[model samples]
Target chain A: MKLHELTIHEASDLLKKREISSQELTRAVLDRIESVEKKVDAYITIAGETAVKQAELADREISRGNISPLTGIPVSVKDLICTKGLRTTCASKILENFTPQYDAFVIKKLKKAGAVIVGKTNMDEFAMGSSTENSGMKTTRNPWDLTCIPGGSSGGSAAAVAADMCLGSLGSDTGGSIRQPASHCGVVGMKPTYGRVSRFGLVAFASSLDQIGPLAKDVLDCALLMNAIAGYDPADSTSVPEDVPDYTSFSNKGLSGMTIGIPKEYNETKGLDPEVSGAVKNAVKVIEDLGAKCVEITLPHTKYAVAAYYVIAPSEASSNLARYDGVKYGFRDKEKNSLIDMYRSTRTKGFGAEVQRRIILGTYSLSSGYYDAYYKKASQVRTLIMEDFKNAFKSCDLILSPVAPTPAFKIGEKIDDPLTMYLSDIFTLSANLAGIPGISVPCGFSSAGLPIGLQLIGRHFEEKKILTAAYNFEQATDFHKQKPEI
Target chain B: MKITKDEVVYTADLARLDLSENSINRFADQIGDILEYVDTLNSVDTEGITPTSHAIFLSNAFREDEVKESMGADKALANAPEKEDGNFIVPKVINL
Candidate 1:
């Protein structure tokens, strides 16, 4: 049995009731990894022996009658988060051998709660790609359809969760990495408010836009995981000081008097499937029937989010990735005698082409003369996008939209065309830019049998509200009941 | 709407990522296509609207400087790809 599929609530109940030891649950996952991991390409590295040892300790504690909510539950983390003593490669050749000597703040928190970390999931090289296809090792395939991509940067976590490799996983969303893959895989993913979770040990992508969140099967399970992971951290300077409420407790309050606004501006079809739109409209009717008021709202600057995000993200990335020079750490070339030769040689061999392109574009934008023209203007456009969201929220308690234009496309469909690949993030990027919470829950199935996600977005640090709304919608619909045949 | 080999070479040098002639040619074609598409951003009317950067409305978020303990020297150098007796070894930074 793949114990990784059991929800935190399920696993916690079993452990509390003494039905199964934490060691047994952890062993079951390790056995599944031995059998099914090769087909999914989901993990970069498996800490199997260490995980077993930790689970054994957890089992001993429970035998002594010591337990926490996460005492025995196995949680998967994105490779980008640092794990002390484990080889934490951000799915890049440069960091292939760089093991962090200290656990990240999030890891420290998880350890305190007695959660067993199974392994690190694969990702784009430093969270750069829309598909984990950009992983230096190999592309992660979707559990639902092996031929299609598992939406990426966080693709491995999504794939692992969907395939029963892990019950829940963490993903860092720079630009729709978590929610998009969750949308594609027919699971639940959350992008918490920017400062709600700390970013201390996560490999930096776009500093301002990056956020770490949970991907699980149900909204309540996600909230349970989020309760342990969220809240302020002194290690992360940007972490906000706010009291984290019991999110799982608030989820049962259905959306009776809530006002959900649908941005008519998002109704435009750059690539949105008509069938997906119809499903979203139908979902709105369901919400209205639940006593929530559905109103039409306008977020006129919605279209510009993608254009601004690409420019700003690359600009920040170009500067952030500068630390990978063959000098201090990561991959270094011995063949080159000179310093410049070594830098060029090491990076040339280490980084993929798409990564190189973004770095160059960013460096050019941030260069003296071009800074005002590209980077500055993009920042200004970013302000407009945030303002658009602020005004939209005034008209409603929450905003709802389709997660993407369509379901997962074939593996090689947009690989050659970079612009098309970037366009897929249009609906999700604005939420990140606005620093609000957005959840992608399974909405309905397309005629093609692929999953469609209805994105529920709320105000800053309002994760509970978003989860409640999504749960209410979920309870009314039977979409989350269907699981992929893996 | 065309790019020359010179621009590709310049971009490659600027990025410090070694690119073969074949990769350069492919990038120029793909990048040129994207640049043309992004030109659509110019059509929007901003008028008096100001451009935005950060989403959260916070101004300053800086941590107070405090002395923290450091790891033992041996543990620090354990994961370095190349290391000297106690420090990380790297290509000399003579040029930059």
Candidate 2:
């Protein structure tokens, strides 16, 4: 295999044996990015020089027998995560030129493990949209079909992994940002349970719903990335003070004694493409064949997930994003003389249409009179949704469904219709609403030659159960082995 | 559930975002449709349920208030659009 094509574990093994230097691996990946970036547009900032420097450092660390599973492996990060001295735009024009003075807790962890930082990938502006077309930066195309979107907010990260621009990448999930894109891009993506991963320096969208996780070529790679990044941090109060398991230790043990739930509501969901449904059904059969018992369960509030999410996510987003006024860092409107005018003008010019729309929606929802009807009501329904997950987990260890209603759509297919675009995330949003861990694993391809994903959701902080199940399925099927011919 | 243009304009003002007349009309329609969709939540029986503001509940994170090394003025103001004398400069906040 080519150097850039190696998974994190594979590359780590080679690096530990002194069979290949980190420099050679990093260069090959950089060369691959340089060659295919125009076709994919998967990155906002390609840190070629820094990646080389980090690789050299990784080589030094490896020679001293200080190698971790991620040591000497090149990986990409979504643009939203703060990286010291590297520009972190969150794919928004407001913070386009802003560079963080400190690394995010996850970035610090990656650096400590000696992983080579490749570059920053593109996403929806402030992670506001399902498709990456909302990104203020360049468009990222699916490597499987250049005409299609690579699924989004984490579009660029998933595309980078699928196209072999990097071994594994970090992507944040807020309402299916990572998993949906990973599904569309035919890669493995996991949204660790909320509070399972610290969000100390993640550019916040919805503080309660956002969690940074991993996107990789397969389930094992996803597990390796999870092991390195998941832990409690005092900096984020929301981070649960629980022990993070050794995610990599979950081997493909045939899923015995496991009971998987298939939500009846999800099976009856509207707009579920037959191809996606077929793929998920096949995945369930595969799990059953591997000694797992499949049962039908109901998350009755599943239909309201998208509705509740739109209100709650935007409501929190408006508050979290209020820090972008002209007083401090990021863009400022120089023409405005008054403080309010500067704030208004700077935001008007700096934010994109989708972002402005969200701000308006959020503000309206949280407005004095409407708060009880919108934000508060949504929160109450959120309570109901959480209860539904709690109830369902009593009967099943994991919930299985299609990651998305359909496979990757064309670039401009749903951009103009925001409501239509929101419905695409129907299958994935409930997990976020309930703060459960979810993984998207490639199960099959559509008749149109696009990949479909099988989503496995576990109770909050039960990442090991889902990872083990996903690994067992991945081992049984060759779907993850099929790479997009970029 | 129809979001009027005036509401969009008013909310934009509240959010400190100035939108164009064209965008105002566009957002009014788009946001109207989205709000109408979100109105589906109105049908759910949520009475007597406590609102969940956060998924994972935790008490206030407390720590010793020790003076630690900060990022410093230089680094903090490094990305500021306008800065001088180790501070960020902005439009005058008060008019005497």
Candidate 3:
């Protein structure tokens, strides 16, 4: 059996009922990783012994009558998230060997919930790039189409889930790293509301925009993982103080009376493929068929989302990434004879060119002279975009759109043109900038056979609403049923 | 989307990424083009609208000052490329 394809809820039931041990599930995922990870390149660090130990512990716990929703399920952490003793590279060479002394807030929660972490998935360096191609490690290929990319930063997590390497995985989304890859790989990815999930253990990328979310093959599985991870952490000041409910309840009622809003500004963008647009439109129809009301809402400042994000994210990135000087922590070059030379050489070698470019842009925007012209203005515009959503949400419960302009593009297609690469994030960046919950659920595949995703956005802290809509749509469609041929 | 090598050097300096003349020239052309394309957003009239940075409506998420439990030194150094005295070891930086 392809055990990794089973949802966490499904696998946990069997394990809890004593049908199979947690170690069996862990070994199945590990065996699949051993057999398939070479082609997918989904993991930068695969934890075999630790995973086995955790599974054994979980098995013992289950035998001792310990049962939890997440018990005995194998999950992967995006390499950007600190995994206690595991190397959290963020796919950057500078931190290639740096391991954190503490578990990220989500890690602590998952461990408590009995999730057996299988491995650390690959990601774009510091969660910067939109394509896994920008990761200093090997490019993470989309399980759906090996020639194409798995969307990025969180590409490895998405690819791993789709390829059946893990039942579910954690992915940090800054500008759609989680959702875009989920779209590219034909899986489910959820970027929980900012502060909905604590950010304590995630290596900072764009601090304001970065969020650790779940990516799985189905909406329920994503919810199962999110429930374990989403809660306030004292370490992250941005963590919310609100109560987190069992989000799986949304799957029961579906999308009745939910207003699915379609933003008009998103429809008029250039490069939006007709096929992908049609798929989202059809998904909307399916949602309506399930008794939800589809409405047209306007987020007037939508056009400025990308521009505002470009300035804000880069500026934050510039500040957040400053800690990686060769002198402090992580890899320092043995060749550098001088401190300055070491700083330059270590950073130059550690970071990919794309990450370097953003850090520079961010630094420039935040520089003494240019700060007012860029960073401040971007922050001001950030408020405007928030207002637009605030107004739009007055009439609707959620927003629907395409996750990417098209299905997964071939590897190396837009890497040379940073603008084209930036444009790839256009559909995804708005949610991050707004700090709202966004998910990409499988809507359908394109004519060329690449998987397409339907983006569902919800009000801040209203992830249950979005997941409910997604779960209902998933029930009415066959998109999630189609697995990768690999 | 035209960019000059000087702009590349300027941005690199701002980013603290020291680059060679060759890399500067290469990134200049690429980043410059991206900047130009992104300029399309300028046409958007954000005149009165406040920019949005986070999606969660809640603010003031700061945590109370308190020490939390941490991993033990041996486990913490599991991925350290260099370690000594149960801490991450690095080249001397700021002299104490």
Candidate 4:
């Protein structure tokens, strides 16, 4: 394979053997980005010079016999993750020119592992939408088909990996940003358990639900990226002090003795395309043939997950986004005559339509006399959703479903109808609400040549289980080996 | 569940946002639909079930009370649109 198309593990092996220089790999990736970035629009800022410098530094480190699994590998970062001295826009105009003063915890980990950051990827503005079309910066098209959306708000990262512009990338999941995009782009993405990775310096979308994770070419690359980023950090209070196992160590442990629960509710979801469901069903048959037991299970509260998520995510978003007033860093209104006018005008102009809609929804829900009816009721339903997963886990080791109801839709398909777009996230929202770890692995393709992903949800902090299952499935099938003809 | 333009304007004002007349009507219809969807939560039985503010419940992470080096004023205010005397400049809060 070409240097730009090499996975993290493959590139690291070649680097360790002194067969390929990091400079060559970085240059090849830069050339690839230069060639395909116009059609993909996967990146907001391209740090070509910085990547070359970092690759040179990595080469020197490798010569000294010091190398991590990610050393000398070029990776993209979602624009929301803070990189000191790098413009972190979150695909929003408010922070378009805002450069962070310090690296986020994950960025620090990636840098420490000697990974060269290629650039920051675009996303839905402030991660409020499911499609990257909501980005104030640019739209990231699915590399598989330029007319289709790369599922978002991590669309750019997935597209970059799919198009081989980067070896791997880091994307955050609030509802299903990371996994859904990965599914659409035909890549492997994992949303590690809540608090499995630190959130310090990650622009908050929904503080309670957001978790940073990895998207890569294959399962092992995802695991390698996960190992580098996952762990406790004193910088983020929500980061749990749990033991993170060596994810790569769990590979080759086949599906024997594992019980995969197929949620009945997932199949009953509205708008679930036949091709996507068929792909998931075929994935289950492959797992069952690999000596795993597939049994039907019911998550009775599944229907309420999307309803609960909208209320909770937006409410927390409104509260967390209150810091972006004109007085602080970010855009300001020069035409303001009064303090209130400044705040109102700056926010009105700085935020996009979807963002404004969410902020309004959140404010209305959290306002006096309405908090108990909206926020509290949603929280109560959230408890039920969590309990549903907790109960399902008692009967099975992992729950299997389709990552999204259908393969990627056209760019402007669901952009106009907010409610229709929200319903598209029905299958993936429950995992975030429950704070469980979930992964999206390529299963098959739709007849229209779009990729479909099979989701495997595990109990809280049971990433090793899901990773092992995904690794075995990948070994038994060639879905992940297939790449978009970008 | 049907939010009016007045409610949208009121909520936008509460959120410190100035919405145009077009956005007011648009947002009212959109948010009203979302609220109506979320109102489905009311049909479920949640009596005596405590609300979940966070999925992974953890107590406050307290640290030793000690002064340490923090971000310098320059770094903190580096991205500020307007700054003076190492402080972010904004419209006057008081009109005496």
Candidate 3 global TM-score: 0.94
Candidate 1 per-residue lDDT, tens place, A114-216, comes to 8889999998889988888888888899888888898887999988888777778899999899999998888899999998998988889899999999999
Model 4 CA deviation exceeding 4 Å by range: none
List candidate 3 stretches off by more than 4 Å.
B1-3, B44-96
Candidate 4 docking DockQ: 0.87
The runs of at least 3 residues in candidate 1 whose Cα sits more than 4 Å from the true structure, single-residue gaps closed, are A251-253, B2-4, B45-51, B62-64, B92-96
Give the clashing residue pairs of candidate 2, or none.
none
Against the reference, the lDDT scores of all candidates come to: 0.84, 0.92, 0.84, 0.93
Better-scoring candidate (lDDT), 2 or 3: 2
**Residue-level lDDT tens digits of model 2 in A1-486:** 899998888888899899999999999999999999999999999999999999999999888899999998999999999999999999998999999999999999999988989999999999888779999998999999999999988999999999999999999999999999999999999999999999998999999899999999989899999999999898898888898888989867699999999999987888999888999889989999999999999999989999999999999999998999967889898999998999999999999999988888998999999999999999999999999999999999999999999999999999999999999999889888888899999999999889999999998889999999999999999998888887
lDDT of candidate 3 at residue A241, scale 0 to 100: 83
TM-score (all chains, Cα) for each model: 0.96, 0.99, 0.94, 0.99
- Compute the interface RMSD for each candidate structure: 2.1, 1.0, 3.1, 0.8
Lowest lDDT 10-residue stretch of candidate 1 chain A: A1-10
**Ranking of candidates on DockQ, top first:** 4, 2, 1, 3
Each prediction's fraction of true contacts recovered: 0.57, 0.92, 0.55, 0.87
Per-model DockQ:
0.57, 0.86, 0.47, 0.87
